[model samples]
Each structure stands twice: as structure tokens, then as C-alpha cells.
Target chain A: MPDTAPPAPSGLAGPPVNLRNPVLAGVLAFLIPGLGHWYQGRRFKAVLYAVCILGCFFGGLSIGHGQVVYFHWQNPENRTYAYLCQFWTGLPALPALWQAKYRDPAVFEDNRLDRELNAVLTATLRGVEGELRGSIQIPPGNPGFGRGFSAPFEGQLRTPSGSVPVKGQLSALMLDPQVGAGSRRRIRGYFDGAPTSDNSGPLVGPIEGSVPRPLWDWYGAPLADTDGSPNSQLNQAHRALGSRFELGVVYTMIAGLLNVLAIFDALYGPAYGDEEVGPLGPTPGPNPTPGSPPSPGTAPATSTPVSPGGSA
Target chain B: MFPATLLFPLLAAPVWAWAGPTRTWYAIPLIISISLVYSASRHEGPPLILRRALRLMLTIGGFMLALLLLLLLLSRGT
Candidate 1:
């Protein structure tokens, strides 16, 4: 009797808001990173969708991490790892394609926003691949965790036949993100009196800032030589300098972990039409061109039909 | 240009390999930088920041390689 039929359901009711068919939404998401939500009138998810895919890639460049070095090697294991890393690390370039498919109907058919998004996504993917192949051979010491100047640097050079004891100071420029910006320090050796220096050219000895701590500083005693060559020690040092091999393994693992987080962000994060919850959609801004159709080109506003609960 | 960039490294590779890893390690980064610049610059529609970055990396890497090469050559000549 009290007109309980919802006042005739004004405005266009979207295909019955099927909250049950997650597969439909998932497929939609798979197709165009943010469409399933956009289809459901969720806007913010769309933005997050674009950024995570694009941002990680840009971030990869800043740290010099995404180098691609797969060369179809003969070793099956090596080839398999190469393929794994490529797919594992290079999978962020698919969402925009998803968005391109379910572009907001209100926006102009040739959506400019979609075009820009595509450009950035493509650039980031290629950039990451280029970065992965390019390796930055750091001298020694762990960078980022703490100052690297303190790490032990020890290796024996190799000769044509045997090896010789080689000694050289391993030093790194402490990328201090504090006072004395761009400062560098050097650790001469791990013995009793290891000479140290900081930014201001050369100091007397043993830099005052953060005492150098040696992690694995060791020297192998000279062994018998057969063909005897000075270059041998250096070669042996090169071979022994596989300390960073573990570091590489660690880095690869970290990259893989980040890839997982990125994937999750791509899936359930805020998308278009996210802000329009609560009593009414975002304090109705001065509706720029109220009567005019919402930008026929821009993806539907990221915030549309407020969240289902009272708090939109 | 890339072929030239790569040629020098390839030419010097055996020499560096025979010489030692310190030299080779330095040389590899240089070669990589050169290849990256050559490759990144070739990508169409990149922003200025990206273009400059590629060139900057190339310059740093090339300079390092050249310096190392020069040092090696000098060491060899000496």
C-alpha cells in the first residue's frame, strides 16, 4: 500500500547488479584491469588498477632492478629460470588492455584517458625488461641496509696455472640520505688499523662517522703455482668474488615477493565509483557543466554509486 | 653506432678475459650501458626524463668503460 516497489527504479538500472557472478567480474578484471568494477560503477578501483601496474615498473627503473638477460642458453635449467623470471617479473603489462575493453560508455568512444594509460603501461614494461638485463656490478658491501664501506673485501688473483694472494681495499660511497649528502667513505682493510675516509677529500685515518664493520673479510694464503701469472690472482678473486651471488638470489626473491603484492593490488583495490558512498556521493561538487554529458572521453568518474553500506 | 659500441667490447673481450675479471667486470657494465642507451633511445614517444636518463646512463657507463679501458691500455702499454 505504501508504494514499496521502489518508486519505479528511476534512471538506467545496470544489468541487474549481479553480485553473485564473481567469475564475470574476475574475467572482466582480467580483460581490462578495472572494468568489472567500472561495470559495477566502482571508480577508484580503476585508478589503483592503472597505478600499480604502471608504478611498480617506474619504481623498478629507479632502483636499477629490472634487467632482462635471457639469451636462450643451452642449459635447460638456466633457460627455465630465464623464462620464469620474465613471466614472473614482466606480467604487469596486461591491465590497461582490460580497461580498454570496458571503457565507460558515457565517455567518448575514442577515450583519450585510455590512450594515455596505454602509453605509460607499455613504456614501463619495456623499461623494466631493459633494466633487468643490465646489471650494476657493485664493488662490495651491502647497499641500502647499511653503509657498505665497512664490508670485507678479500680475493686472490688467478694465474695461468695456480693462484696468488691479492690484497686491495674495498670501499663504497655511503649514499647517506642525511647530512653530508652524496658522501663517500672508504674502508682500507680489516686488520687492526684499517684506514678510512669520508666526504671531505681524505681524512687522517679511520673515518669518524659510523665505524666500518667487516662482514666477510678473509684472504687465502698463497698456494703453489704451476704456470705462474700475475693475472691469476685477479682471476681467482673474480671467481671467489661470488659473494654477491647470494645477494642476487635474495634480490630475485624480493622481486618475486613484490610481484605478488602488485598482483593483489591489481585485483581487489579501490576502483572507479568508489567515493560515492554514504548519505550521498562526494559532497556534490559544482558539477562542472551540470547539464552537459559527463566527459564522453574520460573513464566514468572513479567514485560513483557509493558503497552499499551506510558509509560510502 | 650500437655495433661500434658493442664491437669495441667484443674486440676487447678476449683480451679482458685473458687479462682479468676486474677489467671484464667494468667493461661489461659499459657495454650494457651502451646497449641500453642505443636500445632505449630507439623507443618512440618517450618523455624527456626518460630520454635524458638513458643518455645519462650511457654516458656514465661509457665513461667508466673508457676510463677502465684507458687504464688497461696504459697498464698494458706501460
Candidate 2:
């Protein structure tokens, strides 16, 4: 390529000036908010952008307990629109892609398991109660007390005659036949029909529709598997945060959208004209000629101030 | 000095503490941030930017409040 450098100034000269490369600055800004401004030596603006934008983003992450950031395209119904704004925060938002790809499928699978468990629990309780009332004497040591059963069963049951072999893995306590409660009420309470004094002992009480751990894991928790059950450290953090999850998501999304402005500023100096004179100084006010003294008494030609935020 | 365990939980505290009826206050900081950034991008001098940002914040806050009130009335069908 030919050396196409412009000829040196022919007259008295001033200090040498450095020009900003908009493309490089814009790319840097996109990679990290405010980096482009820092590249252009706008240190103040760079710091401002970095602090405000990143603070909002990280603040949101802490609020959501890291659950608000995932993306889900496979199941469009599950996709959170907040991510659309969050994607503008550049690299910080990329983990959402990893979360969507690896984590969401497992959550969906757990949801399926929860639905199946719910059905089995409901059916098993219905069958047991119906058969017990209908005079079907389950043999003394039958595997399912003479009822054909498929689901895994655990826990003991006591009847009027003797200990009935009541087997079901859903509840952690034995069903007391002498409690004289309706079968529907027992099923609602998941067979923890009566309160036992020993807290360390099995949870045999009329809990207010408390679903099993696996079912609660599916219906209530967003990051149930990663948190390792409801009582795990991560879930405890989530419970503590409560309803502020939405606020966290908003903070992150606002941070990302704000970065879009920084990116634009880096690409094309400020939306308004630069404060300092540059190689291509503020678009030559109304008069085109450079260095020409204004003619006597004509008002100085003023440059048009750009609109708020230099939106264009 | 705070305990080490307290520090982490404090840092990780949700945006709003005891966020019941006062939950609406959470939007104030966000609106201020939005105003500051928007106004800063449009002006050069620090004084000018700060002044514009404050004005913008008030304008946006008032608009949101008006909208909220309008919605509340509409919801009541009054």
C-alpha cells in the first residue's frame, strides 16, 4: 500500500494532537462497560459508567440469588424477558446461556417427577382408605396388605386388630387407623394425621397440606437441584431474600441497558459535542472558515447543542 | 467491627428490607440512576449535567406517581 500521509503543516504549529479511534473504543466498551471511554482518556466518565453499571448488575445478581439470570429458549413459556435487557451487559450476562443449556433441562425433569409422585400418592391413599372401609381384610403379612401395589411404600400403620402392614414411601410417619379422621382429610395431610410429642421422631402431624420434599422441590423452588433440597445453604439464602427477587432482576437489566448508552458514546464521542477541542472539532459552528476572525458586530455563530443524551 | 458471617449476609441482603407497603421506594434509586446517566450523556460540564439529571429525576418520578394514581383509581372503577 502507498504511504498516503498528509503533508506537514506549512506554517507556525501548535502542540501535536492525538485522535480517538471510534471502532476500537466502541468494541472495548461493548466488551466491558465504560472501557471505551477509558480508552479515549475520559477517565471520569469511564469510572462513572463502570461503578454505576456494574454495581447495578451485581446488585441484581445478589438479589435474585443468581436465579434471575438464566435464559430459556427451548421452552419459550419459561423464558424471562428481563434477560433481553440483561444481554447488553456483555460478558457478565453470558452465564445465563450456560444456565439455560445445562440447568433448565434438569429442573424440567424434576417437575415431571413431582407430578408423577403427586399422582401416585393420591392414588395410593385413595385405594388404601377405600379397601380398609370395604371389609377387605388384608392378610396379616401381605406385602401391600393384600392390595396389589406398584409404588414404593414405607412406614407402619396400626389398625383396631393389630399392626397393619401399611407401606408407602411418600410420608415419613405411620398412619393411625384409630384417629377416626375421614380418609380425605388424612390424604390432605399426607398421613401425618396426628401430632407426636417427639420432634426428633417421625413428622406425624396434621401439617397444612405440606407436600413431600420432592414435590416442594419441583413446585416452589427455582434452583432446587443446585441448592440441594429446601434446607440447604443456598435455599436458605433464597428464603431470606423473599420477594426481592424481582428487584434484583430489574437492577441487572437496567445495568445492561445503561451499557448500551456507554457503547454508543464510545462509538461516536458523546451524544453531544466533546468538551475538549478534537482533530474534528465540534462541527464548525455556522461559519465554515477556520481561523477567520468574525466580521465586526455580527453575533458569533453558535453551534447547535445536541439533544439530551445525544440519542442519534 | 462486624462479625465475618454478618458481613456476607449484609452484602447479600435483598434490595428492600421489610418490603411491605414501602416496596415502592425501591424504584427511586433506579429512576435516579437512569436520569443521571441520560443527562450526563447529553451534557459536558459537571454542574450542567447534575442540574439536568436532578430535573429529569423529578420529572420521571412525578410521571410515574401520576400513572400509579391513575391506575389505582381505574382499578377501583371510580
Candidate 3:
């Protein structure tokens, strides 16, 4: 062989390996967005990745008011696909898993109220108009009952004069689970146990013996009963971000998804010119030129050299 | 001690408080971040990265705007 023999051809060859452990770099990036690039000694790129990915993630948290990022599988209706993309951003974004595990304290609180209000209002409305009319009844000694009704009462119920009954039905319907949090909370005051002392009379207690135990359970349970209020710090931070909650969610998800690309870069360096290796190694060669082979008795130039620099 | 009543206003404020009619504007920062990060990944040089990022951002924004216009026209036609 000549003094300058060509290097051995290895299948796993490309750009110079920059990191002590590319796998570690990829893992670091997966865990902390830009950490892999930082591990690879690409400080500027690392900082850029961190800022872009984290900025988007936290911005989304702020926009969505922290309520936007959560994972749930139990309720098909509540399953948020955004978390799928947001999870890629790594650690700072992991609170969503915690939020999901804890059942979103804010959402749980809202759901508790929903279950309560749904039961009570369903019973009340059914008493007034539905098939349960003349059937639903509240029990004596119930906290909700006024002292006067010791006996099981029944028949068409009436609210205090000048207070409309239909309005309560409308308000109750707004608390139904299908409604969004914003719209549901808007009507919370109307049915939140306070005397609707305005146009909707004091909620006439359900008919004695007619109201279901489920409805009363809602009225009696304490506020802290549902999963205790969400992480206060998270709640506070998200609240501060205010109306941009959905936007914050998008930023965070994009950040996470972007980190996925960063992880790939860490594992496989920058994709410069490794295109020669086809799915099945280097492609055959350029097509034969117009008339014939370059030499009268030799084969056409079908297989070109694979690597850029030819052998010495 | 801070009176709990003061906390009510802060806590009770709606999720959509500041986001009300102009929520769409939030896309600007997100797009800029995406452009910067993506371009930075391709080039090690800062100046070239930023220049390419800006170009990508403009291209993306223009495409989005065109899509929006097309959607608006379609809706009006319906």
C-alpha cells in the first residue's frame, strides 16, 4: 500500500464525534430542551434552544392560565392532545403530569360544584316541570330545609313572588358539564347556594322526601372536599398570565416539539452531506451517456465512487 | 395581615380576562421563537442564523396570512 493509503471504510462514519457520549447528550436534551447541545460544547446553540423552547412552554402556561396543560385519559371529552406535543419539551413542562395525576384541582373544584349543582338543579327542575314533578322532595332537618316543612311536601312549587322560576332553569343549564369553564363560572353566583335574592327567589327547597340523597350530598360537602386546590404556585403563575392561557399552551407545546428536533441533532450531529448513503447504501451510479461506453472494450461507468474523496 | 377579601378579585378574575377580543395577536411571539430556534439549529454562526430566522419567519407569516385570507373568502362565499 502507498504511504498515504485511504482510511478504512466504516459504516458508522460521518462528521467527527463531538461529545464523549452522544447518547448522554441526547438524553440531556430530552430532559432539559437544550442541555444536549450544551453538553456537546455548543454554548450559543444551547442557549438559543433553551430560550426558544422554554420561552414557548412558559408563555403557553401563562396564556392558558396553567389550566391549559394537563393530561387525562378517564374522560374522553377532557382528553387534551396538546399534552402529547408539550411533553417533548421535558422537565419544566412535566408539571402537567402532576396536574393530571392530581386531577386538576381547579377543574376538580369546578367539577365538584358541577356535580352538586347538577344534582340539585336537576332535582329542582325535574320537580318543577319534568316527570319527577310532584315526586322530588327534601327531607325535614335537612340543612337546606326551612323549619316550617316538617312533613313531606309535594305539588306545584312556587318561588317568592316577582322572582321567576324559569331563570333558575336557564342558570342551572349553564352549569352543565358540556359548558366551558369561562361560561360555567359566569353563572356560578346564581346557584352557588347564596339566596338568589334577586329576580330568582331564594331557591325554594326541594319537596320534602322528594329530593334525592345525591343532591343533598352536593349541598352539604365542604369546598376542600374535592381534590385540594391545585398547586398554589402553579395557579398563581398561570393566573398572572391571564387571558392568554390557550396561547401559552401553544407556546409550550411548540417548545416541547422543538426540543424533539434538538434531541435528534444531539444524537446525529448536524446533517451536512450524508445524503450519498441511500436507503440501501450509495445509489448505483449516473446513467450511461448518449452513444456508448467511454472505451471500446470496457464496461460503461455505472458505479461511481461512494465517498467524495477518491482513494489515493 | 392582608384581608382575604382583597384576594377575591384576583382569584375570581375570568381566565380570559386580558385575552378578550385580541387573542390572535399572541401568535407573533410564538412564530418568532420558532423561527429563531429552527434557524439556529442549521447554522453555528449567530448573524447568519438570525438573518435566516427572520426570512423564515416572514415566509411563514406570509403563508399564514394568505391562508387566513383564503379561509375568510371561503366563509363569505358560503
Candidate 4:
């Protein structure tokens, strides 16, 4: 008679593995916008990766927009919150996104030939050239040191330099967040000619600040100084967005990555099993024919059998 | 521009002979607030005497206050 001793169960070598419910790979990802894909074993898209790539590329922009508005209203200053808003605003506002993405400080260049040229061109259009002069009075308790002012046109008041005409009233300012007051200050000396405190009001002095020499000097001042040419002031606001573009691109890319990861997770992660191989592995099937009696040389199944002895 | 109130005609003339930025801003909000209150009162048809008078008073009062605030802003701004 052939020996019929049951083969030893290979507990360590269980059936081939395969996962289901791929969506649950990363619970946080689904819970959090782009985290589930990351949980399902995808990297790079743990945070921003999902938002930029997946959200933007996959018609998720509407979702991104709503999310952005919700988050922006919730936390206006947070970079993450700001990006959430910006991402919805889309590519035209890329510069804004770049800043929010990286939290970088924008530094305006010392010269803005483009703005100067534009102003010059526009002023010439209205017959007599228009000039704007203003001084800011920053209170002592404000964040920076002494306040400064901007000269009208800064010598570029004669020619058009850019595509857009320069309208002085609309020119932007490089506002110091710490100062609740004006950024520019006019030197209003005492009746004795001794410099007293700068007055807090609109442009009051002669248009002499339009000369190039003073304009150049004003622009040359440090980024924080209130003393700047009109071009510099506008450029400062632009720079604030300019320096941030690269950073925003990075963050958007990260969001995209997370979005992709989430997609992948939703498509592939497992539903059940601990210490089990990911769903991508091979799965096992019955031995071709069901209910066939075990052969004399057949091995017992590796999985522990459910005991009939547990409380009924 | 429609029916000029006592203060409206004076406020509108300097900048446009019809309006000022500060005054306009104030007027818009006040008008909106009046319309809102009128709707909120849940009346079926036109407002009665007391309601109509109250609406006009709120409209005028709110507009004046908003104008005052706007003037203050302009005085202190560029």
C-alpha cells in the first residue's frame, strides 16, 4: 500500500496574493484630497502631488476651485490655504501661486524702465504730462524704521516704454504689512526749514522728483524702505508675485503628484488582508476541480482552518 | 441719479455733478440694506405707511453714516 501520511502544511508559503478595494490604500488620501493614493504605496504625491497633476489634468479644476475658495476663506495667510485659492484661479495667476507655493519674499529690482516708458507715453497723449507725487508717514510703532516717499514719474515722464499706458493713480505700492499707515512720507519741514515730521496725505510737493537722479536714488533704496520711485513701488507689488512663480510651480507639481497617487490607489489598493502582498500580485484559484477528494499524497491547506469548537 | 435726496444732490456734484466715489459706495450699501430689510419684513404687497416710512428712514440714515465713513477714508487716503 502507498504511504498516505499527510504532507506537512507550508504555513509560511500561503496562496498567491491579490488585493481588492484598491481605493482604501491610503485612508488619509481619500479623507484628505490626494492622500489615499499615497497610502496605497505611491510616493511623490503625498501632499501637493495630487492637487496639481491629478486635479488639474483630470477636470478636477472645479473641485480645486471650490476647495480653494473654501480653504482661502478659512485661512487667508497660510501658504497652503493661499495655494488652494490660487490653484482654482488658474494659470494667469501663476505668479501668485508661485509665491504661495514657496513662501518666498519678492524683491523688486531697482529700475523699472518699462513702467517709466509707459507713463511717459501716456502723459504725452493727454497734452500736458501728468505727474503724481506722494509721501507716506509710517508711525514709529510700525514694523520698519523711518518712512519714505515716491517722486512722480521719476524722470521717465516723457516716453511710452511698455504695451500698457501708465496711469499714476492705479500704480501699486509695496506695502509693509507691519505698518497700518502710508508707505510714503513727504518731508514737511518746520517754518524754520528744520525737517519736522512727514505729513500723512496725498502728493503735495513740486514735480521736481520727476528728475532721473532722484528717481534712480529712490529706486536704489532697500526693499523695505518707503522711499521709492513710482515704477519701483508698482514693480514691488509685481515682484511680490514674480519671485513666487517658480515656488508655486513646484507646489502645483506636488499637488498634481498627490492627485495621481490618489487615482492610482483608487484603482489598485487592497480591501482586506494583513501582511498580504499588494493587489498587484498573482491570485490563487481552486485546484481546477471542486469537491475532489484529497489525493493520498495531497498536502493539507496552509491557512489555519476555522475551528468548529468556537462558541456556537 | 434718479430721485435726489437732500444730501445726495450735494454729495454727487463735486466729482460728477451726480456722484462721488465715497458717496456711491455708501449709497450702494445702504440701498442694498434697505432692499434687504424690505424683503425680510415678509410683506405681500407694497409697504404700508409705517413700514414705508421706516424703510426710508433706514435708507437715509445708513446712507449718511456710510458717506461719513467714506469721507473719513478719503481724508486719510491718497
For model 1 chain B, where is the 10-residue window of minimal lDDT? B37-46
Candidate 3 docking DockQ: 0.19
Candidate 2 chain A least-lDDT 10 residues: A8-17
Candidate 3 structure quality by residue, lDDT tens digits, B1-78: 144433433432332254354554576777788888776654445665677677776767666655755765677757
Candidate closer to the true structure by DockQ (higher is better), 3 or 4: 3
What is the per-residue lDDT of model 4 for residues B21-74, given as tens digits with 9 covering 90 to 100?
Answer: 432342343243333322212111122323443456556755665676587678
Q: Each prediction's Cα lDDT score?
A: 0.30, 0.49, 0.48, 0.31
Candidate 2's displacement at residue A267, Å, is 0.5
lDDT per residue (tens digit) for residues A17-110 in model 3 = 3544667888999899889888777787789888888888767765564455555555454356777887888776565565445443434332
Candidate 1 per-residue lDDT, tens place, B1-78, comes to 476446555755665677676523533433333333232212211242244434555566566657767877788855
* Model 2 lDDT tens row, A1-312: 122322211111111111166668777887788787787776766777787788788777766655566564544444567788988887777656554554444333311221223222322243232221111111122123322212233333434544343432233222211111111212222332221322332323222222223322221123323335776423554576777777887898899899888776665444443232234532322222354332211111122333333411
lDDT of 1 at A139: 36
Q: How would you encode candidate 4's per-residue C-alpha lDDT over A1-312 as one tens digit per residue?
A: 122322221111232222123435434443454444344333432333343334432222222221121111212232334344334322323433332233222222222221222222111222223432222222222112333223233222322332322222222222222211112221221110111233322322222222222322221122232334544432343354453333333334444343333343334321111122224431222332233232211122313232333211
lDDT of 1 by residue, A199-267 (tens): 222111222222211211101011112234544322333244444423333333333333433233233
TM-score of chain B of each: 0.42, 0.63, 0.65, 0.36
Deviation from native of the Cα of residue A36 in model 2, angstroms: 1.8
Isolated chain A: TM-score per model? 0.24, 0.44, 0.43, 0.23
Residue B35 of candidate 3: its Cα lDDT? 89
Indicate the worst ten consecutive residues by lDDT in candidate 2 chain B.
Answer: B7-16
